[model samples]
Target: MSRWILVGVLWLAGASAAFAIDQEIAFSDPSMNTRYLSLIREIRCPKCLNESIADSDAPVAADLRREVRRLMGDGKSDDDIKDFLSARYGDFVLYRPRVSETTWALWAGPFVFLVIGGIVFWRIVRSRLGQPLDDEESAA
Candidate 1:
Protein backbone atom coordinates (compact mmCIF):
# COMPACT_ATOMS: atom_id res chain seq x y z
CA MET A 1 0.00 0.00 0.00
CA SER A 2 2.83 2.47 0.83
CA ARG A 3 4.48 1.70 -2.56
CA TRP A 4 1.26 2.51 -4.47
CA ILE A 5 0.79 5.70 -2.43
CA LEU A 6 4.34 6.85 -3.29
CA VAL A 7 3.66 6.26 -6.97
CA GLY A 8 0.42 8.23 -6.79
CA VAL A 9 2.22 11.14 -5.08
CA LEU A 10 4.91 11.15 -7.78
CA TRP A 11 2.28 11.10 -10.53
CA LEU A 12 0.43 14.07 -9.01
CA ALA A 13 3.67 16.06 -8.69
CA GLY A 14 4.54 15.46 -12.39
CA ALA A 15 1.00 16.14 -13.65
CA SER A 16 1.23 19.92 -13.18
CA ALA A 17 4.15 20.11 -15.66
CA ALA A 18 1.75 19.19 -18.44
CA PHE A 19 -0.40 22.27 -17.75
CA ALA A 20 2.46 24.76 -18.12
CA ILE A 21 2.54 26.70 -21.42
CA ASP A 22 5.80 25.87 -23.20
CA GLN A 23 5.87 28.64 -25.80
CA GLU A 24 8.94 30.89 -26.10
CA ILE A 25 7.56 33.77 -28.19
CA ALA A 26 9.72 36.91 -27.97
CA PHE A 27 8.34 40.28 -29.03
CA SER A 28 10.84 42.99 -30.04
CA ASP A 29 8.48 45.71 -28.86
CA PRO A 30 7.05 45.80 -25.32
CA SER A 31 3.80 47.28 -26.66
CA MET A 32 3.44 44.36 -29.04
CA ASN A 33 3.79 41.90 -26.17
CA THR A 34 1.15 43.81 -24.21
CA ARG A 35 -1.15 43.75 -27.23
CA TYR A 36 -0.58 40.04 -27.67
CA LEU A 37 -1.49 39.41 -24.03
CA SER A 38 -4.63 41.58 -24.33
CA LEU A 39 -5.75 39.87 -27.54
CA ILE A 40 -5.35 36.41 -26.07
CA ARG A 41 -7.46 37.42 -23.05
CA GLU A 42 -10.18 38.86 -25.27
CA ILE A 43 -10.40 35.87 -27.57
CA ARG A 44 -12.31 32.77 -26.48
CA CYS A 45 -10.73 29.32 -26.75
CA PRO A 46 -12.65 27.47 -29.47
CA LYS A 47 -12.39 24.11 -27.69
CA CYS A 48 -12.81 25.37 -24.11
CA LEU A 49 -16.02 27.32 -24.90
CA ASN A 50 -16.03 29.50 -21.76
CA GLU A 51 -12.31 30.06 -21.15
CA SER A 52 -10.26 32.89 -22.71
CA ILE A 53 -7.35 31.71 -24.83
CA ALA A 54 -4.98 33.12 -22.21
CA ASP A 55 -6.60 31.01 -19.48
CA SER A 56 -7.19 27.82 -21.46
CA ASP A 57 -4.61 25.05 -21.66
CA ALA A 58 -6.22 23.54 -24.79
CA PRO A 59 -4.09 22.94 -27.89
CA VAL A 60 -6.33 25.18 -30.01
CA ALA A 61 -5.70 28.06 -27.59
CA ALA A 62 -1.94 27.62 -28.01
CA ASP A 63 -2.39 27.56 -31.81
CA LEU A 64 -4.49 30.71 -31.66
CA ARG A 65 -1.84 32.39 -29.46
CA ARG A 66 0.78 31.53 -32.07
CA GLU A 67 -1.43 32.94 -34.83
CA VAL A 68 -1.93 36.13 -32.84
CA ARG A 69 1.84 36.52 -32.39
CA ARG A 70 2.37 35.89 -36.12
CA LEU A 71 -0.20 38.52 -37.00
CA MET A 72 1.49 41.03 -34.67
CA GLY A 73 4.85 40.31 -36.34
CA ASP A 74 3.21 40.90 -39.73
CA GLY A 75 2.27 44.45 -38.61
CA LYS A 76 -1.45 43.78 -38.43
CA SER A 77 -3.42 46.20 -36.24
CA ASP A 78 -5.27 44.71 -33.26
CA ASP A 79 -8.64 45.31 -34.95
CA ASP A 80 -7.39 43.74 -38.16
CA ILE A 81 -6.23 40.62 -36.31
CA LYS A 82 -9.55 40.45 -34.54
CA ASP A 83 -11.41 40.87 -37.83
CA PHE A 84 -9.38 38.10 -39.42
CA LEU A 85 -10.10 35.75 -36.53
CA SER A 86 -13.76 36.76 -36.48
CA ALA A 87 -14.08 36.08 -40.20
CA ARG A 88 -12.46 32.67 -39.83
CA TYR A 89 -14.00 31.55 -36.52
CA GLY A 90 -17.25 33.56 -36.46
CA ASP A 91 -18.17 36.29 -33.92
CA PHE A 92 -18.27 33.73 -31.12
CA VAL A 93 -14.47 33.99 -31.01
CA LEU A 94 -14.74 37.58 -29.77
CA TYR A 95 -15.48 38.33 -26.11
CA ARG A 96 -17.28 41.52 -27.13
CA PRO A 97 -18.73 40.89 -30.54
CA ARG A 98 -19.70 43.87 -32.69
CA VAL A 99 -23.29 45.00 -32.24
CA SER A 100 -25.02 44.48 -35.57
CA GLU A 101 -28.48 43.56 -36.77
CA THR A 102 -28.03 39.91 -35.84
CA THR A 103 -26.70 40.75 -32.37
CA TRP A 104 -29.16 43.51 -31.49
CA ALA A 105 -31.45 40.94 -29.92
CA LEU A 106 -28.61 39.64 -27.77
CA TRP A 107 -27.74 43.15 -26.58
CA ALA A 108 -31.31 44.29 -26.00
CA GLY A 109 -32.87 41.11 -24.64
CA PRO A 110 -31.95 41.80 -20.98
CA PHE A 111 -33.48 45.29 -20.88
CA VAL A 112 -36.63 44.01 -22.58
CA PHE A 113 -36.97 41.27 -19.98
CA LEU A 114 -36.38 43.76 -17.16
CA VAL A 115 -39.16 46.03 -18.51
CA ILE A 116 -41.58 43.11 -18.75
CA GLY A 117 -40.75 42.03 -15.22
CA GLY A 118 -41.34 45.56 -13.91
CA ILE A 119 -44.75 45.66 -15.57
CA VAL A 120 -45.71 42.26 -14.16
CA PHE A 121 -44.58 43.31 -10.67
CA TRP A 122 -46.47 46.58 -10.87
CA ARG A 123 -49.71 44.81 -11.93
CA ILE A 124 -49.43 42.28 -9.12
CA VAL A 125 -48.77 44.98 -6.50
CA ARG A 126 -51.60 47.26 -7.81
CA SER A 127 -54.11 44.42 -7.66
CA ARG A 128 -53.08 43.48 -4.12
CA LEU A 129 -53.26 47.14 -2.97
CA GLY A 130 -56.89 47.34 -4.04
CA GLN A 131 -57.95 44.41 -1.77
CA PRO A 132 -58.81 44.91 1.92
CA LEU A 133 -56.85 43.14 4.67
CA ASP A 134 -58.25 39.76 5.86
CA ASP A 135 -60.99 40.29 8.56
CA GLU A 136 -59.23 38.00 11.15
CA GLU A 137 -55.82 39.61 10.57
CA SER A 138 -57.27 43.17 10.66
CA ALA A 139 -58.92 42.46 14.05
CA ALA A 140 -55.67 41.08 15.48
Candidate 2:
Protein backbone atom coordinates (compact mmCIF):
# COMPACT_ATOMS: atom_id res chain seq x y z
CA MET A 1 0.00 0.00 0.00
CA SER A 2 2.81 2.44 0.78
CA ARG A 3 4.56 1.68 -2.50
CA TRP A 4 1.32 2.18 -4.43
CA ILE A 5 0.78 5.58 -2.77
CA LEU A 6 4.32 6.67 -3.59
CA VAL A 7 3.82 5.68 -7.23
CA GLY A 8 0.61 7.70 -7.39
CA VAL A 9 2.38 10.79 -5.96
CA LEU A 10 5.22 10.45 -8.43
CA TRP A 11 2.85 10.09 -11.34
CA LEU A 12 0.95 13.22 -10.34
CA ALA A 13 4.15 15.21 -9.89
CA GLY A 14 5.41 14.19 -13.32
CA ALA A 15 2.13 15.11 -14.96
CA SER A 16 2.07 18.55 -13.35
CA ALA A 17 5.67 19.30 -14.20
CA ALA A 18 5.16 18.38 -17.84
CA PHE A 19 2.25 20.77 -18.04
CA ALA A 20 4.21 23.52 -16.28
CA ILE A 21 6.90 23.54 -18.93
CA ASP A 22 6.41 25.08 -22.41
CA GLN A 23 3.59 27.38 -21.41
CA GLU A 24 2.92 29.76 -24.26
CA ILE A 25 3.19 33.44 -23.57
CA ALA A 26 -0.15 35.00 -24.49
CA PHE A 27 -0.14 37.52 -27.29
CA SER A 28 -2.73 40.23 -27.97
CA ASP A 29 -2.83 39.31 -31.67
CA PRO A 30 -3.33 35.89 -33.15
CA SER A 31 -0.80 36.59 -35.89
CA MET A 32 1.85 37.43 -33.34
CA ASN A 33 1.19 34.18 -31.50
CA THR A 34 1.62 32.25 -34.71
CA ARG A 35 4.89 34.05 -35.39
CA TYR A 36 6.09 33.28 -31.88
CA LEU A 37 5.52 29.56 -32.32
CA SER A 38 7.26 29.55 -35.70
CA LEU A 39 10.20 31.55 -34.38
CA ILE A 40 10.81 29.17 -31.49
CA ARG A 41 10.81 26.14 -33.76
CA GLU A 42 13.02 27.88 -36.32
CA ILE A 43 15.71 29.12 -33.92
CA ARG A 44 18.47 26.80 -32.74
CA CYS A 45 19.58 26.68 -29.12
CA PRO A 46 23.31 27.27 -28.71
CA LYS A 47 23.48 25.02 -25.65
CA CYS A 48 21.45 22.19 -27.19
CA LEU A 49 23.48 22.31 -30.43
CA ASN A 50 21.04 20.78 -32.93
CA GLU A 51 17.75 21.13 -31.06
CA SER A 52 15.48 24.08 -31.75
CA ILE A 53 14.63 26.57 -29.04
CA ALA A 54 11.12 25.10 -28.93
CA ASP A 55 12.44 21.57 -28.33
CA SER A 56 15.19 22.45 -25.85
CA ASP A 57 14.67 22.68 -22.09
CA ALA A 58 17.97 24.42 -21.46
CA PRO A 59 18.02 27.75 -19.60
CA VAL A 60 19.46 29.47 -22.67
CA ALA A 61 16.52 28.17 -24.69
CA ALA A 62 14.16 29.76 -22.19
CA ASP A 63 16.00 33.07 -22.50
CA LEU A 64 15.82 32.87 -26.29
CA ARG A 65 12.09 32.26 -26.13
CA ARG A 66 11.67 35.34 -23.94
CA GLU A 67 13.71 37.41 -26.35
CA VAL A 68 11.54 36.26 -29.28
CA ARG A 69 8.40 37.27 -27.44
CA ARG A 70 9.83 40.64 -26.50
CA LEU A 71 10.89 41.32 -30.06
CA MET A 72 7.45 40.43 -31.40
CA GLY A 73 5.83 42.68 -28.81
CA ASP A 74 7.96 45.50 -30.12
CA GLY A 75 6.40 45.04 -33.60
CA LYS A 76 9.62 43.90 -35.22
CA SER A 77 9.23 42.18 -38.57
CA ASP A 78 10.09 38.49 -38.78
CA ASP A 79 13.07 39.29 -41.01
CA ASP A 80 14.16 41.91 -38.52
CA ILE A 81 14.00 39.40 -35.71
CA LYS A 82 15.97 36.86 -37.73
CA ASP A 83 18.59 39.40 -38.68
CA PHE A 84 18.98 40.50 -35.07
CA LEU A 85 19.52 36.94 -33.89
CA SER A 86 21.81 36.12 -36.79
CA ALA A 87 23.92 39.15 -36.02
CA ARG A 88 24.19 38.37 -32.33
CA TYR A 89 24.59 34.59 -32.41
CA GLY A 90 25.79 34.02 -35.99
CA ASP A 91 24.01 32.03 -38.72
CA PHE A 92 24.19 28.85 -36.67
CA VAL A 93 21.14 30.10 -34.78
CA LEU A 94 18.92 29.80 -37.89
CA TYR A 95 17.51 26.45 -38.87
CA ARG A 96 17.64 27.39 -42.58
CA PRO A 97 20.65 29.60 -42.82
CA ARG A 98 20.59 32.19 -45.56
CA VAL A 99 22.85 31.50 -48.51
CA SER A 100 25.64 33.99 -48.00
CA GLU A 101 29.38 33.87 -48.68
CA THR A 102 30.05 32.26 -45.29
CA THR A 103 27.15 29.77 -45.41
CA TRP A 104 27.86 28.43 -48.93
CA ALA A 105 30.06 25.72 -47.44
CA LEU A 106 27.34 24.49 -45.10
CA TRP A 107 24.67 24.30 -47.81
CA ALA A 108 26.86 22.74 -50.47
CA GLY A 109 29.12 20.55 -48.32
CA PRO A 110 26.63 17.68 -47.97
CA PHE A 111 25.85 17.28 -51.70
CA VAL A 112 29.54 17.56 -52.54
CA PHE A 113 30.37 14.85 -50.00
CA LEU A 114 27.58 12.65 -51.32
CA VAL A 115 28.80 12.96 -54.92
CA ILE A 116 32.38 12.18 -53.91
CA GLY A 117 31.26 9.19 -51.84
CA GLY A 118 29.09 7.91 -54.70
CA ILE A 119 31.99 8.15 -57.12
CA VAL A 120 34.28 6.26 -54.76
CA PHE A 121 31.63 3.63 -54.13
CA TRP A 122 31.03 3.23 -57.87
CA ARG A 123 34.76 2.73 -58.49
CA ILE A 124 35.04 0.16 -55.69
CA VAL A 125 31.99 -1.82 -56.85
CA ARG A 126 33.05 -1.68 -60.47
CA SER A 127 36.53 -2.95 -59.67
CA ARG A 128 35.25 -5.70 -57.38
CA LEU A 129 32.14 -6.96 -59.23
CA GLY A 130 31.75 -5.29 -62.64
CA GLN A 131 33.72 -8.07 -64.36
CA PRO A 132 35.60 -11.26 -63.67
CA LEU A 133 38.67 -10.60 -61.51
CA ASP A 134 41.99 -10.18 -63.30
CA ASP A 135 44.37 -13.20 -63.05
CA GLU A 136 46.56 -11.42 -60.50
CA GLU A 137 43.56 -10.59 -58.21
CA SER A 138 42.19 -14.14 -58.59
CA ALA A 139 45.54 -15.59 -57.62
CA ALA A 140 45.71 -13.46 -54.46
Candidate 3:
Protein backbone atom coordinates (compact mmCIF):
# COMPACT_ATOMS: atom_id res chain seq x y z
CA MET A 1 0.00 0.00 0.00
CA SER A 2 2.90 2.39 0.74
CA ARG A 3 4.48 1.58 -2.63
CA TRP A 4 1.19 2.37 -4.42
CA ILE A 5 0.89 5.70 -2.62
CA LEU A 6 4.44 6.60 -3.58
CA VAL A 7 3.75 5.77 -7.22
CA GLY A 8 0.57 7.87 -7.16
CA VAL A 9 2.43 10.88 -5.80
CA LEU A 10 5.14 10.54 -8.38
CA TRP A 11 2.56 10.33 -11.15
CA LEU A 12 0.76 13.46 -9.96
CA ALA A 13 4.00 15.39 -9.68
CA GLY A 14 5.05 14.38 -13.15
CA ALA A 15 1.69 15.39 -14.57
CA SER A 16 1.88 18.81 -12.97
CA ALA A 17 5.40 19.37 -14.24
CA ALA A 18 4.30 18.47 -17.76
CA PHE A 19 1.37 20.86 -17.57
CA ALA A 20 3.56 23.66 -16.27
CA ILE A 21 6.04 23.21 -19.09
CA ASP A 22 3.28 23.56 -21.70
CA GLN A 23 1.77 26.66 -20.18
CA GLU A 24 0.85 29.28 -22.85
CA ILE A 25 1.40 33.01 -22.67
CA ALA A 26 -0.92 35.06 -20.47
CA PHE A 27 -1.05 38.61 -21.77
CA SER A 28 -1.12 41.39 -19.18
CA ASP A 29 -2.77 43.71 -21.68
CA PRO A 30 -5.71 42.40 -23.69
CA SER A 31 -4.87 44.66 -26.67
CA MET A 32 -1.49 42.99 -26.92
CA ASN A 33 -3.27 39.66 -27.05
CA THR A 34 -5.06 40.68 -30.26
CA ARG A 35 -1.83 41.82 -31.86
CA TYR A 36 -0.05 38.65 -30.79
CA LEU A 37 -2.84 36.50 -32.21
CA SER A 38 -2.78 38.42 -35.51
CA LEU A 39 0.96 37.98 -35.83
CA ILE A 40 0.72 34.25 -35.24
CA ARG A 41 -2.07 33.83 -37.75
CA GLU A 42 0.00 35.53 -40.46
CA ILE A 43 2.97 33.25 -39.84
CA ARG A 44 3.06 29.93 -41.63
CA CYS A 45 4.54 26.82 -40.06
CA PRO A 46 7.37 25.68 -42.33
CA LYS A 47 6.40 22.10 -41.53
CA CYS A 48 2.68 22.63 -41.89
CA LEU A 49 1.54 24.98 -44.62
CA ASN A 50 -2.17 24.30 -44.14
CA GLU A 51 -2.15 25.51 -40.54
CA SER A 52 -0.96 28.83 -39.12
CA ILE A 53 1.51 28.78 -36.25
CA ALA A 54 -1.36 29.75 -33.97
CA ASP A 55 -3.23 26.57 -34.91
CA SER A 56 -0.27 24.24 -35.38
CA ASP A 57 0.70 21.69 -32.75
CA ALA A 58 4.18 21.04 -34.14
CA PRO A 59 7.12 21.70 -31.82
CA VAL A 60 8.72 24.23 -34.19
CA ALA A 61 5.46 26.14 -34.46
CA ALA A 62 5.12 26.19 -30.70
CA ASP A 63 8.65 27.58 -30.37
CA LEU A 64 7.92 30.21 -32.99
CA ARG A 65 4.73 31.22 -31.23
CA ARG A 66 6.63 31.60 -27.98
CA GLU A 67 9.29 33.64 -29.74
CA VAL A 68 6.64 35.97 -31.12
CA ARG A 69 5.22 36.44 -27.64
CA ARG A 70 8.67 37.24 -26.32
CA LEU A 71 9.20 39.83 -29.04
CA MET A 72 5.84 41.39 -28.33
CA GLY A 73 6.71 41.61 -24.66
CA ASP A 74 9.92 43.36 -25.66
CA GLY A 75 7.84 46.08 -27.36
CA LYS A 76 8.49 45.10 -30.95
CA SER A 77 5.92 46.39 -33.44
CA ASP A 78 4.17 44.06 -35.85
CA ASP A 79 6.36 44.95 -38.85
CA ASP A 80 9.51 44.59 -36.79
CA ILE A 81 8.46 41.17 -35.62
CA LYS A 82 7.62 40.09 -39.17
CA ASP A 83 10.89 41.42 -40.53
CA PHE A 84 12.87 39.59 -37.84
CA LEU A 85 11.17 36.30 -38.53
CA SER A 86 11.37 36.74 -42.30
CA ALA A 87 15.06 37.54 -42.12
CA ARG A 88 15.69 34.40 -40.07
CA TYR A 89 13.28 32.07 -41.87
CA GLY A 90 12.83 33.64 -45.32
CA ASP A 91 9.67 34.93 -46.98
CA PHE A 92 8.12 31.47 -46.86
CA VAL A 93 7.40 32.04 -43.19
CA LEU A 94 4.94 34.75 -44.19
CA TYR A 95 1.50 33.60 -45.24
CA ARG A 96 1.21 36.72 -47.44
CA PRO A 97 4.26 38.43 -48.77
CA ARG A 98 4.04 42.11 -49.61
CA VAL A 99 4.09 43.09 -53.28
CA SER A 100 7.22 44.98 -54.26
CA GLU A 101 9.92 45.19 -56.91
CA THR A 102 11.77 42.29 -55.34
CA THR A 103 8.68 40.08 -55.13
CA TRP A 104 6.75 41.52 -58.06
CA ALA A 105 6.71 38.24 -59.93
CA LEU A 106 5.65 36.26 -56.91
CA TRP A 107 2.69 38.61 -56.36
CA ALA A 108 1.58 39.38 -59.92
CA GLY A 109 2.89 36.44 -61.96
CA PRO A 110 -0.06 34.26 -61.07
CA PHE A 111 -2.65 36.81 -62.11
CA VAL A 112 -0.76 37.51 -65.33
CA PHE A 113 -0.66 33.83 -66.12
CA LEU A 114 -4.34 33.52 -65.33
CA VAL A 115 -5.16 36.34 -67.72
CA ILE A 116 -3.04 34.76 -70.45
CA GLY A 117 -4.68 31.40 -69.90
CA GLY A 118 -8.13 32.95 -70.02
CA ILE A 119 -7.33 34.62 -73.33
CA VAL A 120 -6.11 31.36 -74.80
CA PHE A 121 -9.11 29.49 -73.48
CA TRP A 122 -11.51 32.05 -74.87
CA ARG A 123 -9.87 31.87 -78.29
CA ILE A 124 -10.08 28.08 -78.30
CA VAL A 125 -13.75 28.11 -77.31
CA ARG A 126 -14.58 30.83 -79.85
CA SER A 127 -12.86 28.92 -82.67
CA ARG A 128 -14.71 25.74 -81.72
CA LEU A 129 -17.98 27.67 -81.67
CA GLY A 130 -17.49 28.90 -85.33
CA GLN A 131 -15.90 32.29 -84.62
CA PRO A 132 -12.83 31.55 -86.77
CA LEU A 133 -12.75 33.64 -89.95
CA ASP A 134 -12.28 32.00 -93.38
CA ASP A 135 -9.24 32.41 -95.64
CA GLU A 136 -11.14 35.19 -97.52
CA GLU A 137 -11.24 37.31 -94.35
CA SER A 138 -7.59 36.68 -93.79
CA ALA A 139 -6.77 37.70 -97.37
CA ALA A 140 -8.78 40.94 -96.95
Candidate 4:
Protein backbone atom coordinates (compact mmCIF):
# COMPACT_ATOMS: atom_id res chain seq x y z
CA MET A 1 0.00 0.00 0.00
CA SER A 2 2.92 2.36 0.79
CA ARG A 3 4.45 1.54 -2.64
CA TRP A 4 1.13 2.28 -4.33
CA ILE A 5 0.91 5.63 -2.53
CA LEU A 6 4.48 6.53 -3.65
CA VAL A 7 3.63 5.53 -7.23
CA GLY A 8 0.50 7.70 -7.14
CA VAL A 9 2.48 10.71 -5.88
CA LEU A 10 5.09 10.28 -8.60
CA TRP A 11 2.44 9.90 -11.30
CA LEU A 12 0.65 13.05 -10.14
CA ALA A 13 3.89 15.03 -10.13
CA GLY A 14 4.81 13.83 -13.63
CA ALA A 15 1.37 14.61 -14.95
CA SER A 16 1.59 18.17 -13.65
CA ALA A 17 5.05 18.59 -15.15
CA ALA A 18 3.77 17.43 -18.54
CA PHE A 19 1.07 20.08 -18.45
CA ALA A 20 3.43 22.87 -17.31
CA ILE A 21 5.08 23.40 -20.65
CA ASP A 22 5.30 27.13 -21.48
CA GLN A 23 4.28 28.05 -25.00
CA GLU A 24 6.49 30.80 -26.43
CA ILE A 25 7.03 32.00 -29.98
CA ALA A 26 10.55 33.16 -30.71
CA PHE A 27 11.80 35.27 -33.62
CA SER A 28 15.32 35.33 -35.06
CA ASP A 29 15.37 39.12 -34.59
CA PRO A 30 15.23 40.32 -30.99
CA SER A 31 13.55 43.55 -32.16
CA MET A 32 10.75 41.55 -33.72
CA ASN A 33 10.25 39.65 -30.47
CA THR A 34 10.15 42.91 -28.49
CA ARG A 35 7.58 44.38 -30.89
CA TYR A 36 5.51 41.18 -30.59
CA LEU A 37 5.47 41.48 -26.81
CA SER A 38 4.52 45.16 -26.95
CA LEU A 39 1.76 44.56 -29.50
CA ILE A 40 0.22 41.73 -27.49
CA ARG A 41 0.10 43.84 -24.36
CA GLU A 42 -1.29 46.83 -26.26
CA ILE A 43 -4.03 44.88 -28.04
CA ARG A 44 -7.23 44.22 -26.12
CA CYS A 45 -8.91 40.83 -26.34
CA PRO A 46 -12.19 41.33 -28.20
CA LYS A 47 -13.86 38.50 -26.26
CA CYS A 48 -12.75 39.98 -22.90
CA LEU A 49 -14.08 43.18 -21.35
CA ASN A 50 -10.74 44.67 -20.27
CA GLU A 51 -8.02 42.05 -20.58
CA SER A 52 -5.13 42.51 -23.04
CA ILE A 53 -4.33 39.84 -25.55
CA ALA A 54 -1.21 38.99 -23.54
CA ASP A 55 -3.30 38.31 -20.42
CA SER A 56 -6.36 36.70 -22.01
CA ASP A 57 -6.76 32.96 -22.56
CA ALA A 58 -9.77 33.17 -24.86
CA PRO A 59 -9.78 31.33 -28.20
CA VAL A 60 -10.06 34.69 -30.01
CA ALA A 61 -6.98 35.92 -28.18
CA ALA A 62 -5.08 32.82 -29.30
CA ASP A 63 -6.19 33.37 -32.88
CA LEU A 64 -5.12 37.02 -32.70
CA ARG A 65 -1.75 36.01 -31.31
CA ARG A 66 -1.21 33.59 -34.17
CA GLU A 67 -2.29 36.25 -36.66
CA VAL A 68 0.09 38.78 -35.16
CA ARG A 69 2.96 36.30 -35.46
CA ARG A 70 2.11 35.59 -39.09
CA LEU A 71 1.86 39.27 -39.89
CA MET A 72 5.21 40.04 -38.25
CA GLY A 73 6.83 37.14 -40.14
CA ASP A 74 5.54 38.69 -43.34
CA GLY A 75 7.52 41.92 -42.52
CA LYS A 76 4.49 44.05 -41.79
CA SER A 77 5.10 47.20 -39.75
CA ASP A 78 3.58 47.44 -36.26
CA ASP A 79 1.21 50.17 -37.44
CA ASP A 80 0.22 48.07 -40.47
CA ILE A 81 -0.59 45.09 -38.29
CA LYS A 82 -2.53 47.32 -35.90
CA ASP A 83 -4.48 48.83 -38.80
CA PHE A 84 -5.32 45.38 -40.13
CA LEU A 85 -6.57 44.23 -36.75
CA SER A 86 -8.46 47.49 -36.26
CA ALA A 87 -10.15 47.06 -39.61
CA ARG A 88 -11.26 43.57 -38.63
CA TYR A 89 -12.02 44.15 -34.93
CA GLY A 90 -12.70 47.91 -34.78
CA ASP A 91 -10.84 50.46 -32.62
CA PHE A 92 -11.85 48.58 -29.47
CA VAL A 93 -9.05 46.11 -30.18
CA LEU A 94 -6.48 48.85 -29.44
CA TYR A 95 -5.83 49.99 -25.89
CA ARG A 96 -5.37 53.60 -27.05
CA PRO A 97 -7.51 54.10 -30.09
CA ARG A 98 -6.72 56.94 -32.47
CA VAL A 99 -8.97 60.00 -32.45
CA SER A 100 -11.30 60.23 -35.44
CA GLU A 101 -14.65 61.73 -36.39
CA THR A 102 -16.39 58.75 -34.78
CA THR A 103 -14.12 58.74 -31.68
CA TRP A 104 -13.89 62.50 -31.05
CA ALA A 105 -16.58 62.26 -28.39
CA LEU A 106 -14.76 59.44 -26.59
CA TRP A 107 -11.59 61.50 -26.32
CA ALA A 108 -13.28 64.75 -25.35
CA GLY A 109 -16.24 63.59 -23.24
CA PRO A 110 -14.42 63.60 -19.89
CA PHE A 111 -13.08 67.16 -20.21
CA VAL A 112 -16.45 68.39 -21.44
CA PHE A 113 -18.14 66.85 -18.42
CA LEU A 114 -15.52 68.29 -16.11
CA VAL A 115 -16.07 71.84 -17.42
CA ILE A 116 -19.84 71.49 -17.13
CA GLY A 117 -19.51 70.17 -13.58
CA GLY A 118 -17.23 73.08 -12.65
CA ILE A 119 -19.73 75.60 -14.00
CA VAL A 120 -22.60 73.94 -12.12
CA PHE A 121 -20.53 73.83 -8.91
CA TRP A 122 -19.65 77.52 -9.23
CA ARG A 123 -23.28 78.54 -9.74
CA ILE A 124 -24.41 76.48 -6.71
CA VAL A 125 -21.74 78.08 -4.50
CA ARG A 126 -22.69 81.57 -5.71
CA SER A 127 -26.38 80.94 -5.04
CA ARG A 128 -25.68 79.52 -1.57
CA LEU A 129 -23.56 82.61 -0.65
CA GLY A 130 -26.43 84.94 -1.64
CA GLN A 131 -28.78 83.32 0.90
CA PRO A 132 -28.63 84.42 4.58
CA LEU A 133 -28.16 81.47 6.93
CA ASP A 134 -30.83 80.75 9.55
CA ASP A 135 -29.83 81.42 13.19
CA GLU A 136 -29.60 77.66 14.03
CA GLU A 137 -27.50 76.91 10.90
CA SER A 138 -25.18 79.86 11.57
CA ALA A 139 -24.66 78.77 15.19
CA ALA A 140 -23.77 75.22 14.10
- Estimate, for each residue in 1-140, the C-alpha lDDT of model 4 and write its tens digit: 99999977865554443233216444546567657777888999999969888778899988898898899999899899999999999999999889999889999999999999999999999999879999998999
Error of 4 at 44 (Å): 0.9
State the lDDT at 122 in candidate 4: 99
Q: Estimate each model's TM-score.
A: 0.62, 0.60, 0.59, 0.61
Q: Candidate 2 on 29-106: residue-level lDDT in tens?
A: 645655677677889998889899877899998888788888888888889989988898998999999999988999
lDDT of 1 by residue, 19-110 (tens): 34544433646456556666788999888999998779899888888888888889999899999899989999999888999999999999
Candidate of highest TM-score: 1
* Whole-model Cα lDDT of every candidate shown, in order: 0.80, 0.80, 0.78, 0.81
Those runs of model 2 whose alpha carbons end farther than 4 Å from true positions after fitting are: 1-21, 108-140
Query: Model 4, residue 73: what's the lDDT?
Result: 92
Quantify how close model 3 is to the true structure by its C-alpha RMSD in Å: 13.3
What pairs collide in candidate 1? none
Clashing pairs counted in every model: 0, 0, 0, 0
Off by over 4 Å in 4: 1-22, 109-140
TM-score result, candidate 2: 0.60
- Write the residue-wise lDDT of candidate 3 on 45-122 in tens digits: 988888888778899988898888888889999899889899998888988897767898998898999999999999
Q: What is the C-alpha RMSD of each candidate to the true structure, in Å?
A: 9.3, 8.6, 13.3, 10.3
Off by over 4 Å in 3: 1-25, 100-102, 109-140
Report the poorest 10 consecutive residues by lDDT, candidate 1. 13-22
